[model samples]
Target chain A: MDENPGLSEQYRTASPWPFFIALSIPLAEAGILFNLFAVAVGGLLLFFGCCAGMLQEAGYVDRPWRSLVVGAVIVLAFGGLLLYADTQVANEAVQLAERGYAVLVAGIILFVGGLLGEVFVDDGEFAV
Target chain B: MQLNGQLALTILMGLFLVGVFAWLTRVENWSGYTPLSSGGSAVSGESGYVSEEKPAGIVRWLTTVDHKDIGLMYGAYGVFAFVVGGLMVILMRTELATPETVLVQPGFYNSLLTSHGITMLFLFGTPIIAAFSNYFIPLIIGADDMAFPRINAIAFWLLPPAALLIWAGFFPIPNLIPAQTAWTMYTPLSAGVGQGNQMNAGVDLMMLGLHLSGVSATMGAINFIATIFTERGEEVTWANLDIFSWTILTQSGLILFAFPLLGSALLMLIADRNLGTTFFAVGEGGGAMLWQHLFWFFGHPEVYILVLPPMGLVSYILPRFAGRRLFGFKFVVYSTLAIGVLSFGVWAHHMFSTGMDPRLRASFMAVSMAIAIPSAVKTFNWITTMWNGNIRLTAPMLYCIGFVSNFIIGGVTGVFLASIPVDLVLHDTYYVVGHFHYIVMGAITFAGMAGIYYWFPLVTGRMYQRSLAKWHFWLWMVGTNITFLAMILLGYGGMPRRYATYLPQFASLHQIATLGAYMLLLGGIIWVWNMVQSYFEGPVVEDGDPWDLEASGLRTVEWDWFDRKLQTKIADGGEEEPVTDGGVVEDESADELDTDE
Candidate 1:
């Protein structure tokens, strides 16, 4: 038997995405804790961007923006439901409306960004 | 806007450090042991898993997925957390010396109390054990790396952020005070009912941090389980698998079952705090007892999850030092599995004083009492393994012996608390505090030290200062008993726990405990100094078998790997001839090696 292997025989020796993803979560948490709209929005942007990068690097998808489009649609639907609950339900929790609005805005941003990336980055003359 | 600026400054500082690091990597003069993508690539054999041209310096630690590197990072992180937790307790102990909140305000004292408990258990205890398992498991099991390397890295990466979120209350953020709900975070008060800072978003941040930690632990548990199941070598079967691996496998199982429940409960509590849910609201559908039930359901198993690996460590290391195979090896393995399975059934024992149904309480009491049998069985085997054997009085062995002694005290006290009558009296008292500190600090941390000292040569390629190690061990042993025993006596005097100021009757014992904590702090400082100094300047271990394991016929696979690496280094003209400094150069027969039970 081999006493030791020459090196870890694995693909993707290193990636910086996990570090950014880790950083983003606490930033998002800080935003929610302190009621910072801009900080929260920025954190979500970095969070999703890093996640999309990771999936594409792992070859989970050929185009990160395409998968993000699906993610955007799903989050938008969930956000809309939360908004409806805040408006229609009598026993809604505190800040349920604010949380819904935040999620809705995130969904809108992701949807627009994904479409733009697909048009400009993926379908461009110098597409990766 | 100030808060925003602070955040920006923090990000800027982080980027500055990264930039300096990137620049330093290009500077050849800034070198000592620049780790390759794989941690040990420099010493790895031609046939060993060595990276062709791995990134050096900070980038290696930041992004590398190698188990050994990850393990080292876990060790460093756990040590840092331990230091933080230790300092918090030292401050609390100082405050408790006179029991009038002399050192800080009662609110901040409460924050320190909450942070200490969570930090020790979640941050130090679990991750320190993870440090050993992550580093050693793949080596012992003959795996190239952990089953999912990237996922393993992600699991560890989650911790720093989790720590930030958990301790955010202590940071200079506006209106974000630390949580005083205690680590248990019992409901009603935890649902922002208290006049204290519990109503602030700090408690919510703490819960989120706790949730992130739980998620991280769950992911790590899955990785360990998958690796152990799929990665063992051909010769490493269930019958012959090492004891440390067995304990870790069992600990991983406990984590898989326990931490997710904690995550869900934490989420529910956070919702109650931030989203105004009635999940834990006192007058609403959810009641206070629900939180107790859920928390302890995860919490009690969490105790075992923190402990079993230490038990494994002592069992593995004690045998080598005792010059014999561990007696009843099969029974130790059986007891490990038994403890893991029975740990779940006894979570309600923590809820005995919660006024649950008498019948349910009795059943929980029985299971709790029964679970002690497996622990005692393992202890019995450890002692029996050392019985009539040539015992070495090394630092690691002393700590292993200390582990058993402390486990006995801690386990017996825990057993008394399992009884309904006894628990009703001792619940929320200094006695309960004494009982767990005995296990967590006395037993578990001792075992961790034993493992660290035992593997010092293997990890650092140098021997630690023997005299300093002994002093460190002796101080901690004396300090642990003095501090904890005083707490136990105070418990008998009807002293309550978690109070910044106590009745004047408890002053003498409190002072004595504080004295003991000072000793522990001294010992801890010595240990850190020894580790740092020894790693860089201590005598190099020229031989593979540093402890002369072959003399006792107790050499294991990891040592075999070490020996092969040393030989390869010599063959490639890498170093001088092996120096005879208590290490044996000759190898034992394969049959003799297999004689290790």
Candidate 2:
């Protein structure tokens, strides 16, 4: 953990910026470039997972706990909804996969939101 | 034969783009080089570039976050866009010179229309308002700078690439079906349906460009809103805030609500085009009307977004030129706010013919008619402002007068179209086209031209040739009336718009419109010439208040700064290039305060 970071170092994020950037590109190029959006989503997750270890290393955000907690909560809530829709919800009411996908997207968006929220400012310690 | 040539051209264009990217970024070290970090003069001023050096040459402009510099750039960029858009319209008018195609293919005409519409609205209209807003907002509110400086720079730099992307198909691409869906880019036409070039590659580019514009505008809105809220000087109260800043504040709020939705809609449109989605694709449980709903929602407010700041400009400028106080000042402000509130409500008037519902149409019609009240109030205020005052028939005043006069024609036509029965008859007719152009080119553009002329000395420290400027004003007055008035007549004669060819009966009006267009084109040429010649060769305005209203005590903060800046430039630019080593440029005055202050 560097105490005083340069501009280049300041740009490094605990949030998965690279994953988001890459995922957006491939998704926009869908049908024209490639039909395999699952690949893009998978690659984004993998990239994020690989970079998640960097959260321990001090970057923009010192604590990184709020983003992690918020992300976890979002995933849990939407994940529960998806589980219920798939297993318990009545058939012919809604397409479980589509609902599940939408919920999954919502969960990830919230997760990213929380992730970025941690690093937006240097609020490392809680205010007393 | 065509196939081989197309493939070769494709390869060539691909390589050219690769070369351009490499040259712009890597080869020239353009991106890596810092423009602002040069050890130049940083000035401390009451309401000016406080923390920044006066950057040298191109870097001074490129890296400037100073609201004044940003404003100048916006003004310059907008003028350039206006010329380009004007040229496209000229070509269209040339084509419409006769019943048959006089100059271009039908495809080419469609592309021209598309380019002209987008460029006029997104490129010329918005940025011109920005030109005034960025420059005047802080000056009027007594703020030193915008709330976010870096964000301001970022907002401006987004425009060039957006403009380039929208016009990409004009280059020698392999399958260059330049977007002909018009500026509306209505879906099913723009979506990958019915085959042909309707699913043109250019449509995708235009959509992306539109997306970038939305991004720029939204960022600019955020900056404007933040600045107006937070950056008012201690002396300036909300009650005392100038009309220009007030309108900008309201316009920014509208932009905040309106532009993001437009951006989202554009992204969905892009996806529908290239990503095999059917958000607005017809008959796939998706409807074409969805795009119309999203578009006109932003679209209706977009007209106000273009006109409001200029309306504010007229409110500010007319009084100055007329040598009188603006009558009904509070009422004008109230009306401005009312217009802002009602702008969101009247977007559905554009969709009355879309067959939505009778009740919805009725409500929208009511709101549309209600929206006209504020405009009428402002017009009344303006007329009252000019009534008994010693009106100076200066170039800017003439344009202001032109603005009010032409706005009457444009506004009155708008009320007629606001009625559902009238709109049902005139929908997609040249009447709608006439109404739109009158507001856009007549009211908004006329006011914009007035602002440019009025602020020419203040912005550039030079006054334009008055004789040439008068010619520009008079010609514009005649040309706009003749052209747009003829359009109303063409509509009355049951002529539909967007057609490359028309019936022989409407030919006479189209010819008259074309003749007037040529006059307008000549005036436009004079405008550019005036700006270029005036900036380089025109007499330096030593007296800051070139209008000579010093004794009248017209309270304008921009003139105060303008006076000081001219002193600095004239004083420094005359004898010695000031010592740039210490990172500050000081005028040769003992007192640092502006004379007004």
Candidate 3:
């Protein structure tokens, strides 16, 4: 723990993606737009997680207002667009259902990308 | 336990393992107990490095974050799994002793076969490699430890529960489902719910275990990838990072791609059984072949994943014994990278009999044959490295020789299997069995043993009994040839594999193979006993470089670490502390020893 203490903490703190992704799986099995619901939740969580990490890396003593606002709005808009399809046009449900898988996969990639934010080496180079 | 009970059992199992791990490393002291330190030769009255605080009894091991300690644990555990897996094979050989089900029921035999393959490949192969890699990579790459040490710990900690879960049905519970899916766990058969009252809760558990192993391997791979790429002490680079790390780098990349896919497949299989979706349910949108396609995609590269490290170890070890730098060093590295890319393209070769497209089959056949070229290059380079050289016939060197010899047969037979014409006839025969085992048992295990012997002194700081190691190596060689060669012959005689009973024509071959199995088992036991007993009480290596590294031109980083420790112990003028051997005498500084010399 003594060797670069902060690195150990970040490594130890569990990632949110696994927990959310696991939750989304059973929900997806419930059928229909429930799968899309899972995808939306996972993406929103990951977006926020990445924001938190990026904010920390950028040396923010307070909340990263500009970035956090930009991140939250972008995430909420994307998720809201999908959720709105659940109640609106009948074709919207069909379209979102088909694209749910694509969203889920994108979420996974985003989470992997988020990992890069906090895991850079001491020389400020990316670890991977 | 039933599938329904697993959700809770999983939680409890996790807690138990974590608790045990914590309990193991939390002891008070490790002073008298030198936790498996391998160093250079010790000179009389010279200072030796002694750890002051000793963590008490077993806890030091359980809680250890030290790479060397972890490596020793991995090596010991791998050997234990190897012995257990081997015993299962011996029982199966006995069952086939007389071309009849003489020893066990068909189902039990199936269970044994399945358990043996899983244990050998996942439990034995990777962990043993992990043993060597963990111990050496940090020292070799000039890093203090793995990039993510805690993740390394987590990766290893996943194994015990994984092992328990795989063989869960056979112990503590009676008549619960036994996972008989073999190593492949191909669909339709592995669906688990199709057979009434024949549901293998073990399949789900096995898949869960497989998933855990994938996570473990992936974590290790990520750590290796990071360590090699970033932690190289300014002097090391892609060109000069050493052959073993380069191979590990390539192997880690493969694992990253291969293992995650395996994990996804295993998870889908779990969903197919528990969830309503039929990802592999035949007659539904999903079918059996999907499983095979996905599996072999990961499976073929997996053969490389298991063997690549040993291949690297061979490249690293062979040169020192022969008193030369490895021949075609750059070519070997290029060939290794070539094979890593080419392995992904050869997966379809395993499916030649699956009625795949004729064009596809032919292409796969070509690529399968193509993958052999790099291996051939490796072989020629090894032999040339050994040719006209001052070869020291040490135990490690002898195993390297055996590795090359067995891998030739292994590789050639693979080419034979790669031909669509021959593969059609020999798809599930004992020839395939013999060929893969030659690579696995003969090449990889042989090289693994070579690495173990060559580095044993470096790790334990004590020399094994040379006479016993000689007996063990010869016995292993003789046993391996006698057993696997008999298998090839049986295949040529049209004997199929995974059969509990065979025609009377196979009686002699089975008996011969059985005898060979007995020999292998005896030899393996001797090796294990030699390691255990010798580690604690064997003669300490007085001069660290037993292989005479100064003359050999073998400049490995571990030798550097050995030099540093020796120098530090001398400069400190540390008094001799009771090491693992329980023998101590008054010690003088390295300066005094140098003056005497």
Candidate 4:
């Protein structure tokens, strides 16, 4: 078995423009406005992982179509879960749902940010 | 997918039978072996690693610092303490089973309940986790030994004598019976003179023992933190730290802050008990509330210290079996830190019904509820980690899943208890008991089992009978849910905790719980049998990565460096391998390697 080269090298030269335009904008809107935080966050995470995978496959940063598609699906899921929660529960359960939504949004933002950061920033410079 | 009691029971019994059969078959077989020289590749390898030479005398067992040996010692001591504590609980349950003081005198029963609660929490729960951490953390982190190996030995040595002193009141010593005050040993009640005029010497001794245990724990915590931070091999970077190592770091941080408070509080109590001081005395000079504040401040975070390491272990093992990287590794790590910080603020929630001011109670309630957010994050991360992954139903993974289920119940109930209005009604009731034990025993114990099963091969160099491990999990799951869930119902019926006797209406539930407790005991016995028998006879694992899979793109240093240590130890005649691929590669045997590059 040959030594498995790590993903860091592939991500080093990728462009951040597609990530910022396609995923970050919609995630930020969903997170701040509709409060479908969990979906937003989960989507963002998926997007980051996807982007990393893409970067590894194609040694470049231009994959707007894939990022946009993944980001939209994430937003929809958050919105759907929010609607379901509002219809299904009351009182503390409702509050729990709301909090879940907020966290989801935060998670998405972090994911997108992490991926974008990985692309734009020098890997060796980032301490951990 | 819908599980019912009958099916669950049958599955459990089947697992038990399989486990027994596996154990029987492995009673005389062995395979994997590593040369002694290779053992030093992990960690710094400065200390002597486990040699093929087995020690022949009793002194060898006592003085040994071998990770495996220490692990067994911890396991044995934890089991002993658990049995002692369990028996006390059984007596309390039997008495409560009738809603009357049928089992023993009221005072003696109080002693039993108090001793049982404290002993199990401090002696059993904490030490059992320590047993695993002590045994496996070094190995998994790719270290040859703990940073402070002698201190490791000292830590284990301190436990038995401390435990003996705490429980010494139970034995017929001259004028000493076990302390009647509850495990928390609340001031005034704890300070009160005994009925037999025997002086409060037992309480004093208990405090002293607790102090000793705290010191020992502090030393161990320092060792864990230092070892993980400083001793990781060059290839093992911050991101590449193993889940268990992460857990040990967090747990050690909790201990660093929490145990010291406990030590200081114990010191104050000791002074009050003997020096005629009024540190916790009531009325004009002494402040009873002061003790409550000090104790709970440490007490609450202590819960996390107990639960977090196991949580870390589960996070590590569950993903492996689920065939996925932990969902949101950074998030889980953040949540752990959040829990630790928030744990400090929520201690006052425990004192809500103790006549704290309304404003204070409300603030505590808010803080307590806030802490739930992090806990919720952790739960969500766990589910997501397992979602759509190629989940393996190994014994360790089962236990990890069980931990999630149990912790969910525990965390939800905690939210209810965090409310001031709800707590006023439930304070000192069986509801509180149910809530905590669910978290402590349910979450922590389940996590411990997950870790034990996950790391059994690494620690013992032998594979535990899978059938038996599965059996142990199922029986324990049923027994734990039944026992603790029944307590929740009992609490709803307005049954108060710490009462030797209860109203007749609570009898049926108490009886059921006691029966469940016995099942728990039986499950535990099966586990001990499996572990012990496997130690001598289980199949030896030769593969470097026994789980047969590794997560790609994982960042922790443990995976990068430690895994290679095992490989090199087996493949290259114990010679130090070159540090390759941008990670720590300390090559003590550089002269031996014939490098063509």
Ranking of candidates on lDDT, top first: 1, 2, 3, 4
List candidate 4 segments past 4 Å from native: A1-128, B1-56, B66-68, B194-198, B550-597
- Candidate 1 structure quality by residue, lDDT tens digits, B39-68: 321221111111222345566677666788
TM score of chain A per candidate: 0.74, 0.33, 0.34, 0.32
For candidate 3, write residues B1-597 as lDDT tens digits: 555464454355346434533432232111112111222111122111222221334534543445666677778878888888998999998888887776798888888999999999988998999898888897787766676554565567667766776777678686566687788887788887565433456667677777777777898889889878876776777778798998898999999999999999888887666544578988884687899989999999999999888999999999999989999999999999999999999998888898879998999989999999999999999999999989999999999999999999999999999999999999899999999999999999999999999988777666788888999999999999999999999999899988899999889998999999999988988998899887866765546466798876686768767655555455546556343221333354433345332
Ranking by DockQ: 1, 2, 3, 4
DockQ metric for all predictions: 0.22, 0.05, 0.04, 0.01
Cα error of candidate 1 at position B521, Å: 0.8
Runs in model 2 lying further than 4 Å from the true structure: A1-128, B1-54, B567-574, B579-597
Q: How well does candidate 1 match the true structure, expressed as C-alpha RMSD?
A: 7.4
Candidate achieving higher DockQ, 2 or 3 = 2
Candidates ranked by TM-score, best first?
1, 2, 3, 4
True contacts kept of 1: 0.17
Residue A123, candidate 3: Cα error in Å is: 31
Docking class of 1: incorrect
**Which digits, one per residue and each the tens of the lDDT, describe model 1 over residues A8-104?**
4333345455666676676765665455555555566656766775565444554668767776787678678867867764663355566566666
> Which residue pairs clash in candidate 1?
A5-B48, A5-B49, A6-B48, A6-B49, A6-B50, A7-B49, A7-B50
lDDT of 4 by residue, B1-597 (tens): 434653564365346435533532232111111113322212221112122222234534544555546667788788789878877877776666676677688988878977887788888887898888876676566665676555566577777767876887877888777787787878777776445422456766676667767877897899899889877766677887776678778889989999999999887776565545568877744577999999999999898898888888888878887777999998888888888788888899989978889998898999999999988998999999999988889998899999999999999999999998888888888888888888887888888888778767765556798888888888889988889899999899998887777777888888888877877877888898999998766775555467766544333433444355455555555454442222334332332234211
Clashing pairs in 2: B42-B583
